[model samples]
Each structure stands twice: as structure tokens, then as C-alpha cells.
Target: MRVLHIITGLKAGGAEQQLRQLLRHLPPEAECDVVTLTSPGLVADGLRADGVRVRHLGMSGNRDLRALPRLVRLIRAGGYDLVHTHLYRACLYGRIAARLAGVRAVVASEHSLNDAEMEGRRRTAGVRALYLLGERLGRVTVAVSPTVAEDLRAWGVPRSRIRVIPVGFDPALFRFDEVRRKTARNFYGLPEDAYVVGGVGRLIPGKRFEVLVRTLPHLPAGARLLLAGDGPEKEALWRTARELGVADRVVMTGERPYVPDPGDDAPGMPDLMSAMDVLAAPSAMETYGMAVVEALAAGLPVLYTAAPAVSDLPADAVPTAWHVPCSAEQYGRELLRLYAAHPGERTVPDVVQRNSIQNIARQTMDLYAAVLSDAPLEVRPR
Candidate 1:
């Protein structure tokens, strides 16, 4: 079947990363294509390397209507069997374009939705109306977490139309390797004996990354902050580090791919995780903490403020995952405690396998089949 994936820009973030990872796991026989409505950065490059056809629509902004006809034309020409849309802009335009192109099966994912926010932006009445209007044109909507599912319901979407499908991680890729740990540290120019504190995500304000930077002052002399993604907040984070007098200790690896591109020199997510002594997620709110789960898969003890991926599971299954209040002092205290206690001989937790990408991929394929056949989702959410 020919499937076309549409997203708002191909920048490296949770939603974009999930799109690439899901496509990578799909069957080889299924023809797939990707179109970015705007900035086609590192992720676009990575997707193309994976042999996925990618296009940039060159959308000037949110108000650009000319791109709609172009997208419809491309969809019609591609003869796609399914059109899956991600992010807000893509959902609104791609759904309409897919319908215009005569595609019957359409899928949209609500990757970010919490009590107060959607897509990292504060929720508004106008946004909700627009989202609902576009949602009606699609057959089904996939929520990345139970919280998002509930939010969709609250947003007036029928419960029957929403299926909760948690973000997934590849367990095998994150298994801790001592050799890889050494190599990754060497590659990143990290000192062999430093106590590295890791945080992974787009360096956005919602993520509260500055909390980690502020915690640097409270940490021991050899402690370091290693951030794995990039966004508008990069320079601000550097400025924060400078003011805190720990700029040299803060290592910002701009926009590394979670699933490595085959020939790329930059270290992949797994290698970076292997180099961390502990993973700190200072985000005040999260829908489904993909990075926290990835850290658990790497056998790193995680201290997080809000992570549905860790919290939704039974406590026994995620012993390594600890919830902390959103504060630098708390994070610093937790870091010191973990340092003294000496956690993880690189032992992965049981929860890692629960949200395994293989299982998620199968569920996703089942979802696609259900939508295509116009059947109700018999979702087995893990």
C-alpha cells in the first residue's frame, strides 16, 4: 500500500522522531512518502537516508493557502492508499488535501495535549475549533498517551474516534554497552570520570531545561549537563549556563537523531544515553515521555517532573523511574542521592519492553488495517 506521512516541518522533536521511527519499522513492501509543510532540517535528511521519499511544501506560514492545492496535487499524483498527518498544521491542511485527492483512509495523531497546552503552545478556543473541524474530516485520531486521549474527549471528540497509542522505543537499540559508553564519551569529548547528567528533548521553554542548567551550581565539581536536542532555546540555555558559571560543563549536542542514519558521524541516541550516569527530565508537563522511557531502556535512573510513560505504568515495573517536583534544588538533591547510591549496572527495566517499538509497530499496523477496513479499534494499549 502507498502511504504518505505529512508533518509540520521535519525538525527533530518527539513527534518528528516518532514519525521517522514508525516508518522505519513498517514493512518494506509498503511504499511510503513524507512531506514537510515548512522547515526540513535534520529529520528530513534522516528520513531520506532511510529511503523514505520526502518533500518540502515550502509553506510560507500558517496562513499559506497556495500550498494546499500543491499538496492535493502531490497526493493525487502519488495515488496513496493512506495519508497520515502529524502536528497541528499538517493535520488541518493534510486532512483536507487527502480528502480532496480522493483518499478514503485518513489518520491523525494528537502528539501533544495536556490540561493546559497542545503542541507546546497554550490551548485556545480558536485552536480547539480549528482542530475539531479538521478532525471531522479524518476517520480516526491517535492519541500519544491516555492523558491526551482524555483531553481529546474533553475537547468534544467522540471517544470512539480516539485511540490511545503510546509513543514507542526500540529496546535493543538502547541496551547499555560498556564499549559504546566509552566511545560515545570520547566522541563527545566528555571527561572519563565526570558525573554526566543527561536531558533529552527540544530545548523549548515548556521542557523547563533551564532547571537542569540551574542545578549545575548545586552539583559536585565534576558533574556535567548534557542536552541532546536543539530548538530556539539553544542560545538562551547557553546564556543561562554562562550566568551560572558552568558554560564549559554544559554540552549541547544540537539535534541528534534517535534512530541513527547509517552513515552519519554524529552519535545516535543510544550512544549518548550510554554516556550518561543519570537522565534528568525537568519538564513541568509531558504527555508521553519518550526520552524518559529511552533512558530506562538505557538502564539510566530517571528523575522526572511529569512523564506519563513512567507514571502510567505500575510502580514495580519502573523501579528506576522516579518522579520529582519541578525544581532545581530537588533535581540537584536527587542527583546527589543517585551519585551516592550508585544506580544501574546497565540493567534495563521491565517497562522498556512494555512500550517496545516492535509491539507498538504491530499495534500501529493493526490500527492502519482497522481504519482502512472501516472497523472499530480493538486497541490493546500497553
Candidate 2:
């Protein structure tokens, strides 16, 4: 099969990361290519390094209709048997372009329970009309979690056209590694004895990073904060840290390299995950917390906001790892509790395997094949 994947950009995030993982596992006989509606990102660089063909359409914003023709040309030239897209920009343009190019199979994924990132304050009546138009053009849509599926249905998408498929994390890349733990800590300038409470995502308002910052003063001494990704909120977060008088204790390691999925076949990610004492993702909204699962795979406990999207994680998997009511004080209390318990010392490695990328990819490929088999979806009236 010749598959073409499309997205707004290749920047690091749950959808992009999961798409990259899925591509790495394509069967030997299949060919894969990717198109980014906007300029390619650091993650796309890794994709190109791994021999995947990636094209950047240079979209000048949401209204870049000029890129549509280029996209149409690429699809026609590539002769893709299937076109899979992620996020709103890609879904809107990719589906129409693939259809114009006469590709019979098209699939798109809804990576968030809310569409705020893609549809901002200009979410006027005209925007909704346009969105409904684009959505109606796509053949099938994949939701990363049931919450997302429910939200899509509520937004008028036909239930039959949607499929519930969870995102996958590579188990091998996330396993416990004592040697790597020391190395990663050294690389980050963290003391070997320090308790590291970290998160990996863009420092943005929607992520609720301030909640983590607010929780810092409550943590015991020797506890440090790490935000691995970067974004518009970098300066804001730094200012917040300074205002809170914990700037020196905070480590803002700007965006890092892409960590390939940790399935046995992938390399390096497991070592990186092992370096952390605990992973905290206090996002206000996340379709699927890929990093949370990655932390779980590394045998590290996770602290996250109580969103339905993250509720799928098993109970007793780690100490205070599941979703809880949002409160910086409460989050701090849970973080401290998890730190004291050292849950991984009691949990088995197999607990992480249940949500590995290998299994997720298999399920995704199966869903793709089913959608391609000409079986009509159980569509319902909106």
C-alpha cells in the first residue's frame, strides 16, 4: 500500500508523535509519505532523517488556499492508495485535495476533545459552516479517545463516520533503565538525589502549566521542576517562576529531539524516560496523554489533570497517577505523595505493555484496512 499522511505541522504533540510512531511500523511491502500543510517542524526533520519523504506546503495561515493546488498535485503524482490526515487544517485540505486527486480512501483523526487550538475566537457561524462542509467531505474520522468521539458527535459529525482508536506509546523506548537514569539526570544538570517533577509539552495557557508552577512552593526541598518543551508561553512561564520566587529551582530545557516510539524496534526513548523520577501533565485538555503513557511504560508514576481523556489509564498502575480534581495545592499534595511512595518500586513492567505503540499500531492498521474494505460505516443522522 502507498499511504500518505497529512498534518498541519510536524511539531511535537500527541497526534504528531502517534502518527510518527505508526509510520515507523509500516509493513515492509508498504510505502509511506507525509505532507505538512505548514512548514515542517523539528519532528519532521527526524522523519526525513529516517528516509520518509516529507513535504512542507508553506501555508501562510488558515486561509492559504494557494497550497491546495500544490497538495492536489502531490497526491496525484504520489498515487497514494490511502490518505490519512491528522488535525483540522490537514483534515480540511488533505481530504479535499485527495478527493480531487481521485484517491478512493481517506481518513482523518480528531486529536482533542475540544477544537479550541484549531478554531480560536473567530469560531463564528461562518467557521462552523466551513467546518461542517469539510467534515462532510471526509470518508472516515478517527478519535483518539471516547471523549473525543462523543465531542465530535455532539458537534454534528455522524456517529457512523467516527472510530474510537487510542494513541500508542512505544514500550521499549519507555522501559526502566538505571544507567540511563543517571546519564539523563547529569545531562539535565539535575542532582542525582533530586526529586524531578517534569512535563513535556508546549508551555501554553491551555496546558495549565501555571498550576504546576503554583504547586512548586509546596514541594519539599530537593524537589525540582522541568518543562522540556517550548512555545509562546516560555517567557510568561519564566516570569511566573520568577514572580513565584522559584526561578532558580526551575529547569526550562527548550524543546528536545523527538523520542521515537519505545517498541522493541525503536531506540533511545526508554533511556530518556528512565531518567525522570516522576512525570506531571496537568493539561486542562488532552485527547490522549501520550507522555503519561510513556511515563507509565518507564515505570514512573504520572500526575495529571482529571480529564475524561486521561481517565482510561488503569487504577493501581502507579501511585496517585490517575486524574484528580484540578487544584495546584491538590496536585502538589499528590505529587509529594507519589514521590514518597515510589510506586514503580512495587509495580511490574508488564503494566506498561498493555498500552504500547506496537499494539496501538496493529489496531490502527486493522481499522485502516476495515475502512478500505468497502464495508459501509454505521452512519447515524446528526
Candidate 3:
């Protein structure tokens, strides 16, 4: 089976990373390639190194009308058996292009639903209309979480058309290592005895990373806040840290470079997680908490706020994850308690069995086969 994956851009984001992981585990019989609607960023090089073909559409802007025909021509020329799309813009354009190119099977994945998309009732009508149109064109719309699937149904997508597929991660990549942890702490200039609280995500308003900054001052003197990711809010977050008089305690590691090596057990996120005492995800909204799950895989306790990806999971699946209130004070209190508890690592064999890239890729390939056969897409309950 030949499949073409379409996405807005190959930037370092949850959806983009999920796609790369999925591609690495696809069945040998399945031939897959990727096409980015805009310029391929850091992920392009990694995908190429993995022997996956990547094409850039050079979409000028949101109103670039020429991109539609260009994508249609590319799809027709590629003769892919199916087209799978990720992100909003890619879903909108990919569905239309696949239809125009006479590709009967098209699947689009919905990764998130932010507040901006649904501020007022009337404002969402246009967005819902576009989504409904895409659902009509595509064979199926994959939701990364059950909450996301519910959101899709609320937006007028038929229940029959929505399939819930949780994003998967490689446990081997995030396995904890003591030596690497010490090295990583030294590399980042973090004191070995300091209590480290880490947050991994884009430094944006929606992520609510400022809450972590606010919580830092309330913690013990040696407590440090490490944020791993970057965005437009970097300068503002730094200013907030200074205003709060905790500038020296905050470390913002601008976008960590992702080096994808399936077999090589080298230091990356595993070392970072090992060095940290706990992971804090204070995002105001999260469709799926990829970082939270990865932290759990790394055997770290997590204090998160309304992470549907983690909350929706069965209690037995993630015992280490604690759902906390969004307030910084509450986060600080919980961190203190958790620090005192000094939670030990629990075996997360269930996480590896259910969320490994291999299992998710197999499930996805099954979905593709079902789509081709016009069979019902079974929603796997966790």
C-alpha cells in the first residue's frame, strides 16, 4: 500500500513528532512519503535521514489559491493508494486535493481544539462549516483522544466518521539513565542537589508556562524551573521571570534539537527527564499531552492540569500522573507534597504495550485496510 501524508509544516510540534514516529514503525509493505504545505523545517532532515521522501509545496500564505491545484497535480502524479493529512490547513487543503485527484480514500487527523476556535457561538459556525465540509470529503477523521472525538461530534462530524487513535511514543527513546542524567544536568548548568521542575512544550499563552514561573518563587530556595521549548512568548516569559524576581531560577532551553535514532540508546529526553524530579504541564488547553505521557514513560512523576490525553487514560495506565488545579499556588503546594513523598518509579509496561510506536502503527495500518474495504472503523477503548 502506498500512502502520502500531508501536513502544514514539518516543525517540531506534537502532531509533527507523532507523524515521524508513526512513519518509523509502519509495515514494510506500506510505502509512505510526506508532503509539507509550506517549508519543511527541522523535521525534514530527520525524515530524509530515515529514508522517507519529503516534498515542499511553498504555500505563500493562507490565501494562496495556487497551492490547491499544485497539490492536486502532485497527488494525481504520485498515484498513492490513500492520503493521510495532519493539522488544520493540511486537512482543509489535502481533503479537497485528494478528491480532485480522484483519490477515493482520504483520512485527516484532528490534533487540537483551542479556545480561539470557539470563543463565541457565532464565531465557531464558520469553523464548524469548514470542518463539516472536510469530513464530507474525507473517508474518516481520526481524533487523537476520546475528548477530541467528542469535540468532533459536537462540531457536526458524524459519530461513524470519527475514529479515536491515541498518539504513541517510543519507550526505549525515553528510558531513564543515571549517568546521562548527571551529564545532562551538568551540561545545562543545573546543580545536582537542586530540585528541578520541568515543563516541555511551546512557550505560548495557551501552554500557560507562566504559571510554572509564578510557582517557582513559592518553592524552596533551590527549586529551579526548566522550560524546554521556544516560541513568540520567550521574551515575555523571561520578562515575567525577572518581574517575579526569579529570573536566575528559570532556564528556557530554546527548542531542543531532536535527533531521531531508533536503536542507539543516547542521551536526549531520557536524560532530561532523569535529571528532573518532576514534570509540570500547566497548559490551559491540551487535546493530547504527548509530553506528559513521555514523562511517565521516563519514570517521572507529573503534575498536570486538565490534560485530556492523560486524564482520559484508564487510572491503572498512568498512576504517576496527578491531575492538579490550574492555579500556580495549587501547583506549588502539590509540588511540595510530591517532593516530600519522593515517588519511586513504577513499572509502566502497560504504557509501552499500548502506546509504543509499533502498536500504534499496526493499529493505523489496520484502519487503512478497513477504510479500503469499506468496513466499520473500530474505536479501540483504552
Against the reference, the lDDT scores of all candidates come to 0.88, 0.74, 0.82
How would you encode candidate 1's per-residue C-alpha lDDT over 13-87 as one tens digit per residue? 888988888888887766789999999998899899988889999999989999999999999999899999999
Q: Which stretches of candidate 3 lie over 4 Å from their true place?
A: 114-123, 257-267, 343-349, 376-382
Q: What TM-score does prediction 3 earn? A: 0.92
Off by over 4 Å in 1: 378-382
Against the true structure, whose TM-score is highest?
A: 1
Best by lDDT: 1
Give per-model TM-scores: 0.96, 0.90, 0.92
Q: What is candidate 3's local distance difference test score?
A: 0.82
Candidate 1 structure, TM-score to reference: 0.96
> lDDT tens digits, residues 56-170, model 3?
9999976798999999999999989999999888888999999999998999888866445531123267777876887799998888888888877777778888888889878
Cα displacement (angstroms), candidate 1, residue 331, comes to: 0.8
- For residue 93, give model 3's deviation from the true position in Å: 0.2
Better of 1 and 3 by lDDT: 1
